[model samples]
Target: MSERDAPDQGDAAGPPRQRPRSRAADWLRRRVGHRFPLVARLAWDDYRHEWLVSGFSVLALAAVLIPLLVLFGLKYGIITNLLDPLTENPRYREIAPITSGHYTPEWFASMSARSDVAFLVPRTRSLAASIKLLAPGSDVGRIIDVELIPSGDGDPALEAADDEDIGSPEGHGEVVLSASAAEKLGVGPGGRVEGVVTRTRQDRLETVRLPLAVAGVAPPTAFTRDGVFVSHDLLVAVEDFLDGRAVPELDWEGSAPRPADRAFAGFRMYARELGDVAGLRAELLRQNVDVRTSIADISLVQTLDRNLGIVYWIIAAISIVGYCMSFATSVWANVDRKRREFSVLRLTGFRTGDIVWFPILQAAFTALLAWLLAALVFFAVQGLLNALFAPTIGGGEPVARLRAWHLGAALLLTTAAAIAAALVGGRRVAQLEPSIGLRDN
Candidate 1:
């Protein structure tokens, strides 16, 4: 047939040749049409008889890729999750170990100097340490709960709000007490808890009493129970008395960090903020004291992160190896079945490169399709697993969740590997010249 006489090919003058499509658009159309005729057309075309193998190749790839991607996604999610609860509420959850030589307000300020530390707390860990409440005997330990100051500036007491940091309290009219403290003091909303004060220059131990109105009573948190947390003024009173600025002053303190040889046991410290803990601890140890954390709490957190990491790696490794094996075998089998077709394309002037490119493209097409399907499958699997396993562990929502980024990354990497596999198999078929391949057909 004459070049201009073919159907879909018109004379240049006919409708001005339809404005001549841009080279890029024409090329794309031709490529798409050539690569994707119906299944029968692709199979019957001598040059494309092996193309069916690619459809199978993609399925194989997805079968391996999807599981691994989901696992890795879950792992990354979990590690980042560890900091969430603490970050959400910086005060109650985030606490620092006592790193200073003594549990004074100054040492508390120094240790909790970090911005991340929401609150610096000083409390006796155990309840039975000591109790000398004048006209009362409630043993106060570490203050557990911190709350919004009901009145005043809605800030912590001045002592709680640091100078630059606001870790000290806002000197308000009301005091917040623990429920246990209310029970121990034998006082209710308006009550009195008194303490002894001795003159710094005098001989006898003197006593002084302060009346504290319970602003509100809260349950015991990590800190105080049957314990009283009063206004910064009250904290000041205790501080001044202990510092010998009050009536009955215990003498002979070289410095604030000093402790009696038989000071009550159990480690504790507080800082103005969370960040300054390291510096405070180091200085205290420099002054000859050992710092220890609550070993149990630290151990629990570390264990969770480690185990999740290991589980992610193992699943990914198994999936990848299985995919490679399945894809390689499927492509090789297709190549053997179509030895005759490759022989004909060789005789028709298709170069070795063209022969190789065909299967490579086909494999890519299949991988793309399979990856999408696999992604959906992965999500389905995740849902199913959650429903099945969650019930055994008290039936709650999962801590970690998969995201689109994880699946997208998996798809790209899997497709690239599929292309590489296709190229390798295509190369072997391309080696057949017309003489060798034509002989078999």
Candidate 2:
């Protein structure tokens, strides 16, 4: 064959003449180009055929994971909600004397004086023995002092709970009945319940049963535990019984019971703020008041606890690595399926550079679709979880809105992974022997 007719070498002794670059080389030259939407569409069509292999592609599986994400979001929602009530508001500690023997009033007086003590709600415990309850077969149980809270700072809920509401004297030996207690006693405001409570100490027996006029009923909170609260007067009565004394004239009922007439036991103290709880405890120790809050080293112990954000970074990194692997495997499989297409392109004078871009385009489209789906799904999950659990968990806020940076970061990382996978496929095409593609085995 003439030199001009040779096929193996670059075009008829190319060094002999100055010639423009081959069409394939020229196509490979870097240039700003329009985004080829049609090229991407074609690649996506080719990639979609693998769905015939049954089971979802990685991206499809991620999209279907909405349920799992919803559950995680619920847990996150509830946990985040509880923090609002705890971190934003004040909490308290209820204290009682450690009865090495019995708490003296002096000890109570001392603990009440502490700076952290929001209120030294004096309280006493007493059992009812003499009064008969309206409920068949059950006598009245002991009356315990209801710890006074500072919340009456002018809330109508407090005003509505007058002595009649509590079913006790308006201001004196008054006490509130629990809903079940009032029902069992067959009493409303102005009605009476009589019961005897007994507390026997070595060789000492005290029976306290007084007719208690109903004042009001205690309110119920869904989260609240069972208990009852009585005015400080009833507590004083219990204290009088404990001290082996009874003033019958004062025991008489009606609203505006006299303060001097009402009785109490040894004092019980509490503080509204738990932050200085330990310090108050130490102060109580100095004052010889043995009552206190959690003094153990339990809360001091350490755990991962965000640990400088290291664990979070590790989790994020793992997620990114997983994304890359899925993206690469998906793109590679799609590229491999088009091996014959690429072979045909080479023969048609289409540069392998252009051919390799098909897989890259597929990677980009799949990531974009998955990302948009994830965004919509995540927000829906956030809303649903907040609706279901936020109020119950006692959060200050429902849900924090997702930010723009989050979407940008996800897209950037995802797009970069797709590009990386495409480049890997491109490297293979760039090095391919076109003749090998054309040869018969």
Candidate 3:
């Protein structure tokens, strides 16, 4: 500035020339428009490029996860097997009175209305509860005395063992025989039998015969003794005839007429579920009603379940914390290494929020892949353990088992932990300044 040297008007008066804006920013604004999709794509590409690091992270995660899965599988399988027998069979749910007590109709009604009470029926004394039975038209004098118990709809003892169409004795003339009784009387379903009640009055034996049709045969496990399940009405009639009370229903002749209000000697009660059995028994005892149940066995199974669950969860918590810290440390180091790259993005108009998502997305991918690997390993080990223990375990039951919901819960927990770990690394990324990129360059 002679022009240049002499009072350069242009340099003195003109606005200072602006440094050219970074083309990367211009391209980002024009083509990408938003930072999130670009951030996500970059995160995925970087994760794929660093295959060795990602693979190691996944392996580490799986190492912890596989053991936890296997442990839970064993716990679940064992506990489930233990509980199944008690739950599936109704016999274990029975609540039998220790001694005969006078239970009124009002008491039975209240018990029947309870949510926990599955079935409740009145019972007579053992002496009057017995009846003589013989198959009609049998050439052999095969008459057997059987215990008569009252049954109606939803009678647990009357439930069929197989897919056969067996039902409870609903009518006075219909009766269900126990396996022993059926065998002894040579009577099956659709066969006719005569039930006789004999009473001695004034040195004379009086006999009353009631014809019965066999309805069904209960399973051997339901009742081991030779017993007959009849309607409550029929049982009451037998009791009445034996008490020297007239049973007009069966045309039985006696001295005294039956009373209008009736009370029972005892009852046959069953709980709706195994868990309810203890509560039902406790309530009865509180009311001065003594009863018996398989509470010791039930309590043992429940204790095992609780103890195993506690052990599993404790191990799981420790492993989860350890793995998460390890994962977070790895992610934080990766972020420190990529400070310049993140700074470049910031300088090119990317927001702190967008850049923070980079590590998080990578963590998610790592967690998902790790879960897949762990599941595969768990199933393999499960198969081997089950096969090895098959002969000893009995019933071809597996020693290890996992359900669909279990796998789903595991996946969710793993992902949540991974995201939590990535959040730590994200905090480090948020503190990065754009000038770091210029100094590095």
Candidate 4:
């Protein structure tokens, strides 16, 4: 035969001539020439056929993850409810002296001048803190505890209001009553009450009566106690009356009197913000003053939350390990059953890498479905728990909540774990040879 018409020796001895690839063909090849789509399709088909195994995998995942999510939600909700107010409210974050010390005017001036000090309210001696309250036009009254809080501008506790006719009374006789104290005294805003201040002399205890009026009633949600909130002036008046010092308003002049040094028991000092509280407390302690803040309680709560989180993670680790084992076992069994199919695919020009994707894809599907189911269960359980216990612990607020990032993280971890578990089956597929299919056939 002619060289052009006959089979060329070069072609016969070597490889056949290849066709030039188009851009579209090259793009397709780059995109999916590895047969990932086929592998995924086959994986899905296998999963459909093995419904029982797939269902069991999903259920196993849900069984482990749902409980952890639920516990985490509960812990988050309870801790938030307990700590939110202390962190959110500037008033509760105030640092106060645990023990009474003679904080002189100079000390007060120094503390008040600090950048960290947002507000400073002086505290009276604890022994003279309690007083009897006399209701208007009634001789019989209740002996109530009084908390001398700082009032006027820059007082973090009290909200400023404009005064008008029939509005809240202000100045010397004005005092705010806690809701519980008001309820007990059967009094409200613009009410009249008298505070009876008591004192102790060298050998005997003395009593001094001071008439006062309720200016406003604090809301029930306030982090205050069953007491009245009096200004610095009223507190000083009570202190002076107890010390046997008399004013012309009360019309009594006494010879017995305490030292003239104006010393406060302690001071309630608020930081500029929550983040500044720790540093302020430390500075106060450095100055040899005993300081107390609700930040300590918040720290304790955070420590508890971290401990609980560690426990939850430990439980989750065990569950994840169990899930991996179960998934790996199932995938191994499935690979064993599909060994011939894998070998056939290998004989048909499919690579080991392509075959490896099959089990991984199926595992991913299983994980996705499981996460969805677990999320549903978690929310349902959260709703039920909140409904049952919200009023008791949360003041009608939801006691369980899950953040969006939490769900995203869980899904990502679950998918990674499932893929890791499926690697065993992928390795098994990679080990098989094309001759296996020929031999089996």
The number of clashing residue pairs in each candidate reads 44, 33, 3, 0
Cα error, candidate 1, residue 85 (Å):
6.5
Which candidate do you rate higher for lDDT, 3 or 4?
3
Q: What are the runs in model 1 whose C-alpha is more than 4 Å off?
A: 1-15, 18-55, 66-238, 246-289, 292-301, 304-308, 332-362, 399-401, 426-441
The best candidate in terms of TM-score = 3
Give the TM-scores of the predictions, in the order they appear.
0.50, 0.38, 0.84, 0.56
Model 1, position 80: C-alpha lDDT score: 43
Candidate 3's TM-score: 0.84
Q: Which digits, one per residue and each the tens of the lDDT, describe model 1 over residues 1-441?
A: 554565543434354345566777577657764323332244345334444554555566776766675676456555445534322222323323443334555554654565534344443323222223432434442222222221222223222222332222234234555556555555554444443333333454544444444554443342353444444344433444544453223342323432323222223343333234445556656856675533344345456767876776676666665666667666666676766777777787656755666566666677778888887887787777666654554235453357777667776877787777776668767776777664673
Candidates' C-alpha lDDT: 0.50, 0.50, 0.88, 0.76
Tens-place lDDT per residue, model 4, 1-441, is 334454422223333666577787668657876366557778899888889988988898888889988988988898788777766565666787888888898888888898878888778786655566767654446666655555545556554222222222345678877777887778877678877766665566777666778777766544357777777766666666666676444554555445556788877677887667888888888988887787767678777878888987888898889989988988898898889998999998788888888888888999899999999999999999999999998998789988999899999999999999999989988998989999986
TM-score ranking, best first:
3, 4, 1, 2
Best of the candidates, lDDT: 3
Q: What lDDT tens digits, residue by residue, belong to model 2 across residues 231-284?
A: 554555545554455545555222333345333333444454545556677775
Q: Write the per-residue lDDT of candidate 3 for residues 146-212, one digit (tens) a residue.
A: 9998998889877766656578886679999999988888778898899988998777899988889
Q: Sort every candidate by lDDT, greatest first.
A: 3, 4, 1, 2
Pick out the ten consecutive residues of candidate 1 with the lowest summed lDDT: 143-152
Q: What is the clash count of model 2?
A: 33
Candidate 1 overall lDDT versus native: 0.50
What CA root-mean-square deviation does each model show from the true structure?
A: 10.1, 15.9, 9.5, 10.5
Question: Which sections of candidate 2 miss by over 4 Å?
Answer: 1-38, 48-55, 58-305, 394-396, 399-401
